[model samples]
Target chain A: MTASIIEDRGEGSPRNGEADGFPTATPLPVRTSEKGEEENPSSILLGTSAEDHHIARMAALALGLSVLEAAIPSPLPGVKPGLANIVTLIVLARYGWRTAAWVTLLRVLAGSLLMGSFLTPGFFLSLSGALCSLAVLAASQHLPSRWFGPVTHSIFGAFAHIAGQLLLVYFWLIPHTGLAYLVPIFAAAALLFGTVNGLVAAHYLDKNPINHKIQRHREMRPDCL
Target chain B: MLSIAHIKPGDWLTLLLGALLTAFLGVTLWQGGAADKAIIRSGGKIFSVVPLSRNQLISVPGPLGISQIAIHNLQARIASDPSPRQYCVRQGWLKQAGEVAVCLPNQVSVELSGKQKNYDSLNY
Candidate 1:
């Protein structure tokens, strides 16, 4: 796991959105996945105790947010690289699929609580997106990695995320009149923006070679190949 | 500037699929513009939120054509509508849904309810 170094905000005043009554959702630190699950080693060692669980819960908060910050719109306001997703991909690439899936659930819960959008349809929408990405990662097993470059991986995963959102909204719960249309608009948004994120991520990976620290057997594998 | 050489086939497929989905949605929403009487019981404040006549309803014109908004408060009534506003009158009346049409101090907010309409639900 990459050692996370967060800038500490003192006990003085609350963070930007914290003063609005709702406590800012604290995130958990990154941890290794065992049995393809988001297991914070600290909490596991401390036992299934409630306080440890709370600490584990806070770990995914900021990292999940970072994934979201990635997807950028071409026009800027809408353009962003799905950065937080890199975390998702990384989790999957290292720990396998289930751990990434669990991480996504945690991210959804944390993001909703932090954004004060808990239980809203929008929260569910985000969950669907994460699930969609998971689906892509799962399905990618059939294809050659050479076909899925960092950019393509991000793009396909983003498409899956958005498609999952549309599927959830249009099929299961509240059937609004024309929500079916939001799929394509958002999918377009995902693809158009997703490509840029993928490219940037690709560039980043190229620039930052892996150190001898993390023992990754798949390091020999090309992400695109 | 980024090159398209890096884009994958799946990328194009997703974009095409997304566009097709949008086209279908636009048509459905446009065709089914009218919603039936939905009575929501919220907070004990009676709300009459549905449309009186398909034609009498005040709809804001956009790319989607018209949006039906119902009024809520007495304050909203005092305010002047650029046109004769008639969302106040409707078929079924109830208030528990937390939807109210307010024509208040220089403002108009026709609370739209996300009920009964077949909006999409999360499946998998």
Candidate 2:
């Protein structure tokens, strides 16, 4: 259905549309375009590998969630439900930590840019939060799958995320011990949101489990899949 | 929807640990420790450290003028500040360690400290 929409939009000039942004599985034309370009139009495609495209799409989804979350009024400056983390949890469970990290970091960077907070203290706080959560997720992903799942990972990630951001606020921004008073409130938020996000991720993963054949194929030849 | 059956032992463990962590943070970081002394600084320098137990009025010289810090009944407060805005003066009282009141324009600040150093370097 999505492919058909893309094809319909690109019907006017398929190669041009593909060259601009929308990457398709269709083979690139060997011959130069009628526009008299010397190089292959495929060269204009931003991402060559399937993984890059996957990450880009996932990142875009996460960015949308971040924007949506920003619209909701928060009680405290740093206290947010972090709805984008749900997408990160889903990506981590489905694809893997590396892909999830790419999606998450890209979302943070692009989200900051979109919010006009890039390079500001807010951006650093956000970056630190994302980094700490990613680290926790990466480590927790190694735990026994039989015993642990997305919810467990989400809790750890959420705690780490808030902890990192609070530490940054104390040392970098406020530089006062008074900030410690807010830790419990932020931690409570982390716990609540973490459990909620983790449950969502678990339910989604359970409904749409990884295809064993595809997983095997990817393990055999990672680039091809 | 996630049923109770979907939560594994590890998930329960995580939830438990997260609750414990939050409780720990609430207990330790929420209300600061009892302060024993008040450290006053003027012009970016430590002017004096006075015991909170002994009630006294400290007059510290700053850029704007003189700032008066009052310590009474184991509590400290900025009695007066020469700065335009009496922010520090209006900050009522400081009885907990790590509490601080700053008169920016006057370049005077007072911070409460506890016996065991409310927080170490690593806590930052």
Candidate 3:
């Protein structure tokens, strides 16, 4: 049992026959006869916890919002209202910054992949924006909660998002002083969208019925996530 | 459905800060810096770098013929080009830094360079 516990399984080994942290008395029966002689028996299956499920669900919600946003005709490129941020703000207020970061990054990666912009300049820009915003939120969330709320964090996150993208554009893509001229427009958009998203997040945080379930779950598992 | 009552004091502070930042960027970046010199390229090679202070006309020999460029009032423009399209001549004035006028047929291009760069990229 100790040897099996210490042994490193193949990278793609299936988890069906093994218990998580607990050794099984007998191996699960292999029903390979019905399937015939399999050419490839390797399989990959990860043991996901409840928190993973929550993050995956929230990430799917954010992706849905992103898809809706992509359909809207924006006046300027790289200047959208960032509707998906509402979910990040809600998650931050409920689950904390780590969970919020997970949701935001997953949204960016999955959203870009869905849009077929993976590994492109657009994907990098979105990645930088998400990272910068998450950093800002992580810091700003530490402020006294009495005065500050999701709205404040949202605005700061939005500004950081645009700042990150613009710097990337100036340094990597354009490398021109001319790009500075677009800063004002981008800043204005960030301010407007940040406030709007923050308000929406605040409203959702206050009114959503899901908060009760989340609160109950948090109380049950105080430190898992 | 949220209202003004839902806004917190910190939210107001953030709004004030974001607005001030946007205004500051608008004031500073909207206007490009004054150009310092004009760079003339003829047939893919640099013909000369002329100061905008000196009001003069430079005749650059290109593939087709001579192209004349004038600099005056801290601005430069293509006065005449042997190119049939006259696109460079029609460009009128290059007042800001990084502004460029090119005559493809004559293989002549004039650009303004200074401490700051002008907006040139439009990504769709």
Candidate 4:
């Protein structure tokens, strides 16, 4: 049906081409005039992919929830799953850092627009953290081949990534004079939240949950399928 | 029964040494100039900085909400509609290098830069 519509609109593969040579398969080019603004499954599929990108970003926002921030009481502020970091990490690990960086940038742009404001500073702060996370993920991949546990690796990386955000907080956010007091609070919170996310990521890494959750999508594409 | 068999002494050492070094660095950064991060909590809400010390807190009639600010040497262009008392006004003064004053209610935030610079460039 979708192929037929695409063909009808002159946007699909071509007129002479048959998607599959089967008796019931309509030659995707059969354009009938009555199908005005009728829902095209092919276009809807493309629209769905854009929606998936939006969903991924919403997931990023969900992970960022904490304290009075997300309606759940987290003892820390600025705490997030760093899942988006993990998303960027896996993308870098499998593809390469540059592509993962682009993914991160796209996710931020999409996430911010879906969130409805590029003018706000929070989005930029998140963009900063994502950039730093990408940097850590890229550099850490080349480290010496050591007998590794995924949990420990995650802990180390997660902590480093959180620290990346801290660097921005310390060097850029706080006034020149206010560093003495802020450190204690942020440290206390980082330790608390970092351990939680580290353990969660570690557990997921151990179980390879990322494969189950996200890996299924890429396979759904026709080329992969 | 302890098993040294599971431990790659080098990897453990690296992880340990790296975490310690990072912690030390974090603590150092925290201790370096961290004293100025004053989180002002008013009526059970947190505000980054509100410059006016005397009027640290205020209540807004109806749903527009309340706000606070910390004033140091920072100039702010606030969207006055969000009752400033909401999440935006509580982020008081953005006078520090990397400190961000967030007004979530207004979807506004004032970010402090390392050096005081022209925000007009940011307009573009």
Q: Which digits, one per residue and each the tens of the lDDT, describe model 4 over residues B1-124? A: 2233433444465456655755775666543222233344433355354442233333222234443333333333233335535445444444444555555554334444433222222211
Better of 3 and 4 by TM-score: 3
How far is A114's C-alpha from truth in model 1 (Å)?
1.6
Q: Tens digit of lDDT per residue, candidate 4, span A1-225?
A: 111111121232232233232211232233434444375533322122232243344335433432223355545556555445444444443334554555566666666676675646666666776666666656665655365433333445555655666677667665343433444555444444444444443343344433432234333322211
Q: Judged by TM-score, which candidate is best? A: 3
Q: Across residues A1-225, which tens digit of lDDT does each residue of candidate 2 receive?
A: 122111122123434322332233344435544444555545443323443456677788889989999999999888888888888887776657767787889999999999999999999999999999998888999899899988899899999999899889878888886677778999999999899888877877777656664365345443222
Q: Per-prediction TM-score, chain A only?
A: 0.59, 0.79, 0.79, 0.50
* Top-DockQ candidate index: 3
Residue runs of model 3 more than 4 Å from their true location after superposition? A1-45, A209-213, A216-225, B35-114, B117-124
For every prediction, compared with the true complex, DockQ reads 0.11, 0.36, 0.51, 0.07
* Residue A143 alpha-carbon offset, candidate 3, angstroms: 1.5
The stretch of ten residues in a row with the least summed lDDT in candidate 2 chain A is A1-10
Q: Which of 2 and 4 is ahead in TM-score?
A: 2
Give the top-scoring candidate (lDDT): 3
TM-score, each model? Answer: 0.46, 0.66, 0.67, 0.42
**RMSD in angstroms, all models?**
16.2, 9.1, 9.9, 17.7
Worst 10 residues of 3 chain A by lDDT: A1-10
Candidate 2: C-alpha lDDT: 0.80
* Candidate 1 CA-lDDT value: 0.49
Please state the interface RMSD for every predicted structure, separated by commas: 5.1, 3.9, 1.4, 7.5
Q: Per-residue alpha-carbon lDDT of model 1 for B78-118, expressed as tens digits? A: 12233334343332332322234443321334433333444
